[model samples]
Target: MFREIPTVNRLLQKKWNDKDQQIHLQKLKNAKSTFNIKKRRSSSRRISKSTSKKDKIQEDRFKQIERDNKILLQKMRRIMKNHSGVNLPFEKGSLNKGMRKKQLADITLANYQLLQRLQDKKSNYNVLKWEKDRIDNKKLAQRIGIFSSTMVDPAHSKSKQALPTLKNPRESTTRMTKKRMKKNYQTELQPLEFPSSFPKRAKTTTRKRKRTIATPEEDGDKAKDLDLAKVCSIPEEREVIFQASKNDGKKYEVEISQTEDKMFIAAANKVKHSEHYLIELEKEKGEEILKEFNNNFQVILDNLKVISRRLVLLNPNINDPKRANTTRNRTRKKNFRKLNKRGNASQPSLRPGTVNSPSGDLMGVMPETARPVSPTQNTNDLQA
Candidate 1:
């Protein structure tokens, strides 16, 4: 019985050992399953957290993009409104509609490109302008077809036409007086001795009567009747002039002379008239003289008058005391001193010389000696 009981106990121990081992294995499986589930949950939590942060960042970026777009749109709207009146060359229909976002962006990019191109064009335009200016300056210097004040032709600038000559010539009047004389008689009455063949002739006597001379008026009328035009067909004198001058009241005599170069005044002596009668004639002659004078002479006379007036105005002495006082206050004077000359103070100096003294104290002197030459035995030195 005791041995049997011992075997049963061994069996029971083995059974217990198997059951405990089973339990241990089951616990290890359960723990492994729990660990796997915990690891999966932690991984899911981390992924969800990362996803939430990414969503928030995307929302902020979207809001920022919208704000930037609104600002840019406002600026574009202002630009569009200000420049609405300006139309594109070929897009007249597009003027009534607002530009699309893509179109606005495209326009902005195009504007940027256009600005760059414009800047480049402006620089090139400036360069071209400078080059053109240089070319124009060169043309001006070369006296090309360009018309500039500094490059005017010398011939065109100077006047080539001469002034006209005086139309009227000046002249004068003259007068003459008549005179008569008588002579004494001493007659031999016999013919001057002429040698003949020795023949004597008796003296003969005859009665004679004096003839009366014709009056000046009758002779003048006769001369008038003569054909003077036919008789003097040719010009017999170098110069001929006919003039008349008044002597007494309403009395004038005509004169013909050959001194045409003496002008109208050549008849001045011919006009032996009263003062009142001569006054009228002198006035007429004076006007004719002025009419015949040279233009250059008139200009010279005008300039002389102006210069004389200026000299009178600038004279040191003034007729008015107020002007003299003003002049004295405005005038300035410089201090000057006379130099003390060494000798010949009264004599004027023609030139500076060692023996002569200077004209004024302004003179200065310097000591100078002849060039020194060494004595040589050669004849060339003596010649020098």
Candidate 2:
């Protein structure tokens, strides 16, 4: 009923309160916009805060730089005022003797160290270079002795006698035979048969150690149950251990140690004495022998050749013919006839449990194998 008048007024009026309608429309737009508030206010506040923080930092840095420059200037002024012209921290005016001396020492030391460092690294740094070009791949290889050796190829050999030819045995047969003969002679070397030989070599006899019953208690209770031995490296340690030795009180016992050995080595320090006994010819002969032993390898080789030749001449009977057995009677071979009975059937035989059967022409017999289990005797023996 209240809206009927307003409806009639809206119909009657062509432009019914346009300004008021615009105001209402503007109010509605304002109300819709109010739902979306400006989020940039807090962001703008943060941005302002960051800018202020940056400004503060810049100001602090500038203040620090100014302070440092002021301190440096003050120090420079102090240095100029001082007699020593040193830039060390000083008292208001003059320093005490101790401080002055310390400052001078530090200054001198610094100057000396600076000079030394400059002397070592005197290369001109002003001249720029990409690289100094000191690349050497074989530097380490050059230092190693084996790498430095002139010989590199494994196939290259120096001696006329090349490696033994395994494919062709005849190629190295002469050398092989010679080496075998020399080895045989060396292994079977015996002293010359001398009628007046007084036998100077001592004949020592090895005494057997008495056997003791090794009980489990004795073995387990002993401190040396472990196979590993306690080793002492220091002299003091060994000395401390000497008192606990089992042979400490024994007069007949001899103690031997692994280290700190003062047992006078007769050959230490001094030039090795003449190996020649000097009982033979003269000093000249001795010197010649010494020189031959030390240097003249060819001469030694020649001497050895002569010795081998002499040995060949002396041992002309290298292959002794196999002598026939004149002493040993050659018995005629006994013919063993096969029998037709079990050789192991001894239960019904003359001797019970004996692995034997009646020896007869028809009895079965186990044939004896020709292969001899025992080593054959050398027919060339003096006994044979």
Candidate 3:
């Protein structure tokens, strides 16, 4: 019974082992299939993405090139329009660098042919000019008074005619002087004023000053005594005044110092009613002279007021030519410098028939050369 029980257990164990192996094999097969599908999908997606990025880059570059080409075409069209009068064989669409080279070569050939034709024409015109000059000389010789005559006059005619009688020189001078005098008398003369004088009115009249009445209450006041002492002690001083006059069309103001000499002269001029009263003097005329000085200053003040009014009426523009000339000159100098620089740049490469020389070489000197020594100086002095 033990042996039979062992055989049955072995058979059951073998069946369970076979079932487990089959389940594991199926799971491995399913896993391998899913893995292969996933790998294929990933590879296809990567390839599609790479192709899309490449296409996008290519499209962007093409668009940029097209934009640049359009801009270049517009610029070329503008040049063509500006030179519309010129007969160009190239089309607007074919104005690229390679096409321009061919066009330039064709133009050079055309210019060479035209120059040759012009040279031939110029030679022919020179020949015609020589012929015309020869014909003109022949015509000039045919006219009378131009060349020697062959036939002589039948009448008794001498080789040279007699000279006419000379007229008297005195008659010519007398005739000219009389004509000049007549002209002078016919011209009008300007009227002149004579030195004379008329009765003159006095510049001012002296008025009698009114006297003030003193109050009765101040007859015995102590304040009056103090005022009298102060007034009597005050010091006297000579006053100065300035006088202005026009001399040689220029204004001059002088401070006149009081002197005893001018005092008597001023009094005499005042009594005589003379126009030279300003140059005269008087001993008691100090106040009057000061008043005249003030009158002169008042006249100057009135003139200044008139000048101010004139300034208000006048409108001088700030941007006038006289004011802006300095600015214009600065601009002109700057432009001149720019032009000189441009001229130097344009001639950087020397021409075929020209020789290029440095400044020192043109001046007959070398940059490293030493100056000549003076004859009075000794060689030992130079060495020291």
How should the candidates be ordered by lDDT, best one leading?
3, 1, 2
Give the lowest summed-lDDT range of ten residues in model 2: 263-272
Q: Per-prediction TM-score, please? A: 0.15, 0.14, 0.13
Clashing pairs counted in every model: 12, 6, 3
What lDDT does the true structure give each of the candidates?
0.38, 0.35, 0.40
Off by over 4 Å in 2: 1-43, 85-384
Superior candidate under lDDT, 1 versus 3: 3
Off by over 4 Å in 3: 1-95, 122-143, 146-384
Q: Clashing pairs in model 3?
A: 263-282, 266-280, 266-281
The residue-level lDDT of candidate 1 at 52 comes to 100
Q: lDDT of candidate 2 vs native?
A: 0.35
Task: Residues 98-177, candidate 2: write the lDDT tens digits.
Answer: 89899999999999999999876756652323222222223443343233222322333234355864566656557889
Tens digits of per-residue lDDT for model 3 on 29-84? 88744354443556888999999999999999999999999999998999888976
